[model samples]
Target: MNAIQFITQNTQLDSKSVANTVSLLEEDCTVPFIARYRKERTGNLDELQIGAIVKFKEAFVALEKRKATILKAIEEQDALTPELKSKIEQTVDTTVLEDIYLPFKKSRKTKAEKARKNGLEPLAKIIMAQRTTDLEFTAGKYANANVPDEAAALEGARHIIAEWINERTDIRNQIRTQLEKYAQLETKVIGTKKDDEKAQKYQDYYDWNESLSRCPSHRLLAILRAESEGFIRVKISIDDDRALDSIDRKVIKSNNACADQIAMAVEDAYKRLLLPSLSNEILKQAKEKADEAAIAVFTKNLRQLLLAPPLGEKRILAIDPGFRTGCKLVCLDANGNLLHNETIYPHPPQKQLREASKKIASLVDAYKIEAIAIGNGTASRETENLVKNTPFKRDLEVFVVSEAGASIYSASKIARDEFPNYDVTVRGAVSIGRRLADPLAELVKIDAKSIGVGQYQHDVDQTKLKTALDTVVESCVNSVGVNVNTASESLLSYVSGIGPKLAENIVNHRAENGAFTSREAIKKVPRLGGKAFEQAAGFLRIRDAENPLDDSAVHPESYGIVKQMAKDQGIPLTKIVRNTAVLKNIDLKKYQTETIGLPTLQDILEELEKPGLDRREKAKAFTFDQNIRTIDDLRSGQLLPGIVNNITNFGCFVDVGIKESGLIHVSNLSDSYVSDVNSIVSLHQQVIVKVLEVDIKRKRIQLMLHKG
Candidate 1:
């Protein structure tokens, strides 16, 4: 009907909250802004709830546009009637709306169109009435030069009846319901593709049969991918006899020759028209559901990876490990600025252990390195061992970082701009080092898909995948407030209201005018209007500003409120901040206004309690068991330390100091049924798992979570 009614019906949210959220969205207010700042207006809805409301609002608008297009098309054909127009206007379901307009749709000549042209409409109508027992006489009356004889005329009449049966809304819905609930997806392998090398990955799905409704999303996507690659043929099937019987009861009423004629038309309609169209429609709907599920998995994993523990502001030495190419090393300062670059060969063709050790010790002493990070790639384990054995004057922690998207970032334009004189190896080493210092800032420069944490990423819908990932990145960026003076353009671009162009402008302004002194100084940037500032102010932090509140999450609009709290207590604002004793005793009711409710007041108190606190955990160093180097070394029932690198709906993959990661199926995750894998383990979490089975030939390892 309308935006408010449609969204309310679909979501079952408070109509008033939905109305206010829709209004805020129409005004170009971002989701983070509304969820954080407008608590009183939206009934204190969270980001997820507000995001759902936005989705339904967009769906309602798209539905109305489609209705307008269909209504205009019907009127142009001179087939618009009062009853038909009223039905089309009142319908909300897309499928039902299309069914109402099917009869008037323009198409190429078909059997029904040819039959109507041969003056067989009268004969078809008589058979449909089911009261004409003498169908031969009725058919003879319509016989002409075009029909030739009674048999020919009857055949044409059957074609017209079949089309009428196909166009009936109730009949189509009945068959659609059957397909939706009871259809099975069957696949058969192609004879020539059975032994093909590229087709072996999908061999399990080559000859498979499963209920379409019960099939998992990951399995369905795999089957569809195999069919598309020409390795198998898939068919969606249902009980033909049962479906035909149901349709016969609906169309045939009289026990005579007319009834028999209707029965033949019903079979033709079910076999030739209804089955093919509805089967494809049902398959499309299933694919969409699978895409959404896969996207949800990707979104969750990306968020966890983006907010992974950061080794905050540490001077570090990073290495991109390799064998014959040697290990590429880069030394970075506390702010992640590169100070020195070189190559060291501790293994393989060179075997210059003495020279490599001396270089590392010299760099640590010269650059004041506090930690060492090695890339988990070609020769990760060997490099880690070397770093641990080397004798240094001071104690330094050795960390192994996942180098999933390092190569992609090394060749990117951003990397080129950051390092104009260095080669790709040096750039990659720097990425590894920066990731150890602060993961959120460095990972933002690379693409999410290249991060290597998703399953079936290439097969899912690209547009939907990008939208979901972008929303997650934005949510994570705003939740952990950004430092205005130190954040890169990539990180600043994900702020509440500042997009790519505005982010570039902010960077340029900072370069020319030096660092931002306070929150008010942000307004001086070009084209950053009042609305953008209002949306972006709270999420942007300034360190060591003249006003102490600039570094906190408190919005500029509420600065007066914080000052009032301090003035009423007869103390400076600095004393009230981070003083739990004083902050806990202050009465929040005295500060509440018409626009500011208890929720806003509580948030202000919370911010004052811990100002400019990084919400991420501190990074800790992990060491893999040296005895286990490859899949061949793993033994059954042996427990070892590991880290969760990727997650999916079915299970999670853990790395146990080898190139081939082990799989821990959902069944092995715990004793109880696991509906979600994230509830148990997260990305980059240290876990201990016991080896259940190892297939050396296939390079597969099965692991079970070991609590003890």
Candidate 2:
């Protein structure tokens, strides 16, 4: 098959653009680099389309490698005919190629091999021809010392015929298609473990049966996970008689003395060989489709979470709440540097409310804390209540931040290196504050899987998951340009071409020589060369740079054109950079060159109007309803405010200020049909939901979005 043509038809892009993208990918150009810098060459494809092309191109290369292996194996067997070789060379689908190679595959001693050794090949060929008469006489002629009876000879012939039918590409493909369209996935809970406490989680799947094609991705993954954990047995199949008939009709062409023997062989093949392999292939296809859907959801969630609005630099107080251990409190300066940390127990078991209130007020006044960020964990609501009741020197914006990965980050190596003198508690409190300040910068430090925003993250293919998540991070980081002087190594590591080692170098250089005054100064760092600078400079912003455009998205290569625009407009570069009035009057068409199209020039014009502007909105305060602080306090049909905490294929989990977060199934996301949960709700989106069901024993709550 022509891979490039297939890609063009699948991705709906021009063949020239797909070919150019494939060539660039072969040269080791990163997707972000190509999408951002090579728009003129790619027909201006975005990262999503470019990423698809890269994946399919790699698939085509893998297909070719598998074909070579199959061809060599067949040739070594000395049965490779010109016609067979030609067919194998032209086939593209992996399954079809495997089917064509099946008869030649080396295998353990089988019934067919033993039957052939006993001189049953002629009888088997006569039965397959369906033109034979006196089949019993033929079977008797094949009998020898190994096969001494007519019955034994007939049975051996049937085995040989079954093997031949099992390898036919036409018959296998037809059965495979039937299975794909009609198969049902079934699960049976382990009998002895039905009452086991550990197995109780899968009780709902004890006798579950669903059409494999119609099964939702989340439910399928959940069942597979349960099976992998050894609490259930799962299988995919259809009606046994129907499946047998499909192969029987395809293998037996006519009714004759050989017809009955042929029918027996077809049944044996369907039962002993073809059905098992075909069932597995059908389920494998279903699993791959489910993984794609789950990964897409995870990709979208990670994108939204990484780009969540940052509170920006501010003096803040952060709390990681607990009851017996007290709340781990820390004060952070405008840049999120840890200033002070301590523990306070204002909740029960200590109930030192008066003293804790006075201490909190004093810290707020002493540190000039402008906002309060409390982790939404144990005692989080109580802590917020206490903080809101206190009379501070300045009004504070209180935010109940999701602390999903804060503990993981606290114990991480990056946290230890950043705060060698502190404990894990202090690092965790600091993380809570920093993420509230800038989610993108703080989040990149932790593993994306631990963030708790994915559906079946641990169950999905880890390599593919990591690659996709890394792409999301890179896209978000470049989409919102990084601050060179203040960015952490983890953040800078995601900037177009710079990786962890180079990020460390940039941070060390800044510490030794001072802030980067111009984007060009980045080149002075060890090992950061022209190519790296070319790929990374536009995405790395330097605030208050010597050259104003250095802090914007306009690449350094286009600096000359921007300068000419300023010159033609008869205004100083500094004055014209942010002066929308002057930028609006200039003709973007005047700057278009052969290498630069109108797309690039137009992007440059937008950058000129908003130099170094952040794409995310400013973070706002969110509150949960006070009356519903605990699960026991919840009631059916009651309206309560919530924030979407985690999303999956089945539904979204919203935190309503309780230990158990409520689930809004995709069916309940809208009054209209909601195919994608993201279209109606997003990570951290605030809305009101009505309680549908509350199961105290299961610690689960069902919720529906409140329309009004």
Candidate 3:
């Protein structure tokens, strides 16, 4: 099949649609752009589908190029027979192609080649065929040419056949498949030459053994890490009986001397060559699976973290908690604009407690602050206590926000643009406050992986983790439209079509040209282009604009249709919005087209019902017990309310008023099968868990979801 046809078939898109997307992508049109602007041509494939088609097309082209190169390489060696050439050409998978080209491929000196050069091919063939032949006669045949002893002759013949078995592509493939299905991975810890006290965290992995397929990603990664640090050795072994039986049935039959030699040769080939290569391949595959699982967990956490409810355009005073350096406080207006900044010495030594309180009261009075956001970092609890007890107006509420990546954003370029004259600490306080205003918009400024949400996040594959988290961020940002006029460049970058550069351009254009009055003004931004506008416009809101639809998520392309519907209903667009009576009468089926599907239509209808409405609710304020500050305070059978920090393949980590979170293993996640922890719990969700076990020495806390 042609590239477009192949992509369409694999991805379940129309052939014509795939072709058009591929052409646009090839011409450097971005995914968001094509999905938005070229909807008519591409049948309105989403950015995700267009991206899949682009990736598939590239992979197909790469495979074709690799096939041609392999064909040429084989022909250049003059070992390309019609049968072999045809087999190679027919091979589509890279692994199978490499397997077919194995024999013809150049290699280092091998025992079989050496033995053949020494005139032992005849003896080797007899051994391979497993013919009923006397050993003395075989020895004589080999010795006649070199005048070697019986042992050396047998060795030479065995070496020749061993290499022959190793060179057979079919045999290797068969063995690899069998080993992958049946092999048991064995891990042993390296006994310390020194004291064993220094490396106890790896103690459990040192003697672990499990089937590769059944082993979880975290455990596998742990074992690999132990092995890498010279604290353990890992090996894969198949059941000897099954392995021998398969080889005997496939390669050897009669119990002759030749048969015995062939069996020995095959065993040697597997032990000395094939097994090691196959084990490495299995390990590589295992690592890939582990990385994917870790990335999935991280992605889920990031999504939850980003989608956490916003405080809804309220004025907030953010305090970045500190001790010796004092606290950095910044006040942000309703639209996240910085209004004031100050440093408060709320803690010891400089203990200007009254002055700190007075400064906070004045700032709150000046900005009409509706809430107080205190960063959950060093001295966070102290700050919270101060805010709670201080005699401020009873109308103001206090929240302790997880300022995980606030520092990272404070030093970012977006922060620089927003507060050019402010110090990083001051910027950090502003970020903390803005996050309370809108979590998704502010969090997108910092890297998702660095949000301190997942377990063992640093130990996972960084690149794969980053890509997955980035995808989740993009999906979340686009899923909830951003305020085009108020969104920072970092937030804008996560929009469907707009990326880092385009986001920067948008921000730059805004700074130079002032606030955008309508979504149409975005197209005038340099380098934004039509495609970028198409993907981003629907998700960007221009509140109180000339066109009421611009404030809603109704795509500019669908404006005429929405207006017509509004006119036919004999109501203003505003009345139709969020009015169930007006919305129920509208027939969505009549609007069906090749470009717009049920999913997009339903989404548009929902947006029309609640134009520019934030779907997330205000998060309830929760505080863990100060007395139970660490795992030491957690007792077995004790039930405690905790927030789910992360959900991984193996378990969920819940922070139950402790420094170290407890793990609720997958088996104990629920009574029924809990195949995925994400299905059971999510990040920042409050859950009551019972402490199942606590290993104080190991600092491990095992928790159960079944609370009594």
lDDT of each: 0.92, 0.89, 0.79
Alpha carbon lDDT at 493, candidate 3: 84
- Top candidate on TM-score is 1
Model 2, total clashes: 0
lDDT of 2 by residue, 1-708 (tens): 678976786678889999999988887777888888789888999999999998888788898899899899989988899999899888877888888889888374999999998888988888888887788887788778999988999999999888998898888888887887888899999887788888888888999999999998888888989998888999888888887787777777888878899888888988899888888888878878888898899999999999999999999899999898999899999999999999998988999888888998999999999999999999999999999999987779999998989999999999999999999999999999998999999999999999989989988888889988998999999999999999999999999889999999999999999999989899999999888898899998988887899899999999999989989988778888889889888888888888888888888899999988898988989988988888999889999999998888888999999999999998998878888889888898989999999999889999999999
Query: Relative to the unseen true structure, what is the Cα RMSD of model 2?
Result: 1.6
> Candidate 3: how many backbone clashes?
3
lDDT of 2 at 88: 88
- Candidate 3 per-residue lDDT, tens place, 377-443, comes to 7777677777776777648878778778887888888788778898999989988888888899888
In lDDT terms, which candidate is top? 1
Error of 3 at 567 (Å): 3.8
| Model 1: lDDT to the true structure | 0.92
Alpha-carbon runs more than 4 Å astray in model 3: 1-62, 116-123, 130-154, 193-198, 349-355, 412-420, 455-460, 570-580, 589-602, 626-633, 636-638, 692-697, 706-708
lDDT of 2 at 136: 84
Clash pairs, candidate 2, are none
Tens digit of per-residue lDDT, candidate 1, span 1-708? 788988889988899999998999988999998999989889899999999898888887887888889999999988888888888888888899888888878364878778889999888999989888678988988888898888888888888899999999999999999998999999999999999999998999878999999999999999999999999999999999999999999999889988888899899989998998899989999999999999999999999999999999999999999999999999999999999999998889999888998899889999999999999998999999888888998999999999999999999998998899999999999999999999989998999999999889999999989988999999999999899998989999999999888888999999999999999999999999999999999999999998889999999999999999999888998888898998999999999899998998899999999988899999999999999887889999999999999999999999999999999999999999999999998988999999999999878899999988
Weakest ten-residue segment in model 2 by summed lDDT: 1-10
